[model samples]
Target: MRSAGKPRYASVMTDPADFSQSPPQEAAPLDEFSLIRRYFHHRQGDTVVLGPGDDGALLVPPAGQQLVMTQDTSLVDRHFPADMAPADVGYRCLAVNLSDLAAMGANPLWFLLSLTLPEVDEDWLAEFSRGMFELADQAGISLVGGDITRGPLAVSIQATGSVPPGLALRRDGARVGDQICLGGVTGAGLLGLEQWQAGQRHGPAIGHFRRPRPQWELGMALRGQASACIDISDGVLADLSHILQASGGLGACLDEAALPEDPPVLAGCSADKQRALQLQGGDDYLLLFTLPAAQPVPRGCYCLGQVDAQPGIRLRQRNGAVGALTVAGWQHF
Candidate 1:
């Protein structure tokens, strides 16, 4: 499934393996408001009562529903390569924030972009807005308002969406007996990143890295089904631990062999390194949640493990021996 030029998968991974073959290039150097008006000012729908040109934009939340909001930021090199395509950067900036809304089982409505550019490059801004709006339109999201400043290249997006009152998925609602599920394959994005770092620009892994499709539809479907939910921004072990800790000391057990493995992206890697990336690699914006055993598993989702009574993550090896994790995933001190 492709929404606005980005792939949406029904299985472990979505396929649309195309990307830039060249290394990230330097940005070419623009007026800020002129750029915004030229590219960012797209039309809006009913949800956005007032669009992007005022003191503050007015939004009309659907009646009988509560608003769910989330924000995420990406910095040059820290989050993505400094010279990566501005279009990919723009798409990722909004997509990641939208993933947060998806984890909460919300239908994304509007978003605000706060961008810091070292220097305003018209070409970069055009491509960036193109990618951003492509995903936004596909998801029915509107760019309500935002700010642009001169600084290091960084993007922070604050997205707002709607979910029925009392029905929003939460990280703290998981129970002891619920099953742990993954929205898509992890580590592919990391694989993409590694390839980019190695100066290899185009491949399956880089495609996944550059353009990640958020599981918004699946999230909406999980509304009453998922006991607890979170997006995989910081990798499985770390993000899953957040659910466990939030759910009041509930632990989880993962079957090592049960995890999804994709050959094209992970081929040639040692088994140990493969497992480590799957367990600990960050930047894979997939969803992780808990569901009851009786509920039917949604298509495009994998059952990785189950919530347990104990308090920390444990991995059950193929030989049936369980071991504890000293380091689960990425940490941002």
Candidate 2:
């Protein structure tokens, strides 16, 4: 933690006799350039074609015919808490962008980050850089370059990846009668947010909200089999709409009974509310893809619905009454 009026890059006195062993004292503020030099520059990796100290980054493309690109932004008080751990924030800021690449069936390659902070806290920056480097190394992606600006707390990351030529999964490939399959559990992140807002301390459900591991392997496996693919960032119903409209199709028969529910979510809400959250809540980040009805769904995936040529989405209840499915996900406005 950095305190008010401290230099962001000040030397730390680690000896207990030298410094009080109370709560860690915050570091002093630093200028934008110094902050970057200390935390964002010269990371140990060879994939970085252009390191920090420029307007943008340059990356070496994999020896392939196609490339995939995606960008994601997280805002303070909007995407996360102002006082949240800097390490978690750094990890998630990059993770969400990587999820977009996974949806396109692209291999993790390189990334650039842009950070805006209200103040420069050395301790916070150290932890944040550690978190970003840890995840990037695990995923085999390099931090090429980025920028730091003084402003309200916000973090934005842009990631670039490679995919085999002409094989990247897209939204327009879904066809009539394609079966909708979902990877991993849905609604866990949303339920996590609810738990956090309710003042609940650390738990598995809430942890999902803080750090989401995108299904990179599953995404690569879906490269050729999936007719259409989209990560559930804006909730299942709303994101599915992108595939539906792009494919010029509609009326997916979502079996409410077939939807998977995380136990923590089920324990927190009633059955009806749980169903609603699963359908409308956002930030699941799991892959929702469509494949031919005759194809076998990969293991660990579930059949959630079937595509139709009808004009709107439909939900089939246990009672057998069908109605228009509501898209009640995230609203930036």
Candidate 3:
């Protein structure tokens, strides 16, 4: 197994596939405002401008640019384990949304959270709020306003941020011959979730899934340098295909040998199976980006492959064999 410090994309390994045979029990819903006040509200600094309890959140935009907006929702059974820690759930809910803003190279300003629970537990809400605030504090974003409703356990967050003029990274910007780059590790979170569900005791992999560390700083750094960018929310190959499709016939060639690998992952499975898992698993919120081939790849960026005129995504294996990359990842439909 490789050291944990190595790039996650490069290390490839597989593990025994296990899934929960039955669903976990659910939690009852509780008070809306108290829950918000206890967990999702508050701010660390003046960047918040407007804290929770308004019609909408107000934030200061960059000197000459417009604010970018993104909203994401995580459900109890679908998005997370019903029995998972409330604090981790709260933190992940906010972190994933912030990741989207990061991909756009936006400085987070304020956010709105709409939470629905069957019945709230004071202790759960407290811990959850603490986790959410801890991460929000790090990003300097504030919770402004949102609604609370009675429903199945669900957490929905809408985040707003700002970036310099004409610099927000988007899906439609990749061009043929652009170099493909990935920021940070991938697959650890998905593998972690799988392990946790299979009765594996808590460890680093599970922690990666529950509390993902969004590369906000790296996202900010890539703002002007990357021509196209997208957070790997679904899966690496699947998300990268969005860039290709948007670029009108532009394709991607992913270098399988160059992807970072997780030590635990390598320790768990055969090399071939590991490669398959790495290419298909999701919940890795790392950023996938493209830059001009002529420009030097920036620090913290991994040179995965390049944009080709071939019109579809392909994987270049270690032995020089090329094959079609799967579009499998998380899917709602």
lDDT of each: 0.81, 0.78, 0.76
In the range 244-327, model 3's lDDT, one tens digit per residue, is 888786888889888776456435756775675566778878888999988787777688899998877888888999998757
Candidate 1 structure quality by residue, lDDT tens digits, 56-155 = 7888888999999888888888887887888898888888988899999999998988777765467888999999998998898999888776567778
* Residue pairs with backbone atoms closer than 3 Å in model 2 (clashes): 1-26, 2-26, 2-27, 3-26, 6-28, 6-29, 7-28, 8-28, 8-29
Sum up the clashes in candidate 2: 9
Residue-level lDDT for 230 in candidate 2: 95
Write the residue-wise lDDT of candidate 2 on 32-59 in tens digits: 4556677876454555567676666665
Q: Put the candidates in lDDT order, highest first.
A: 1, 2, 3
Regions of candidate 1 where Cα sits further than 4 Å from its true position:
1-31
Top candidate, metric lDDT:
1
CA lDDT, candidate 2, residue 265: 43
lDDT at 111, model 1: 90
lDDT of 2 at 23: 27
Which residue runs does candidate 3 get wrong by more than 4 Å? 1-35, 54-58, 261-266
User: How displaced is residue 7 in candidate 3, in Å?
Assistant: 47
- What's the C-alpha lDDT at position 77 in model 2? 80
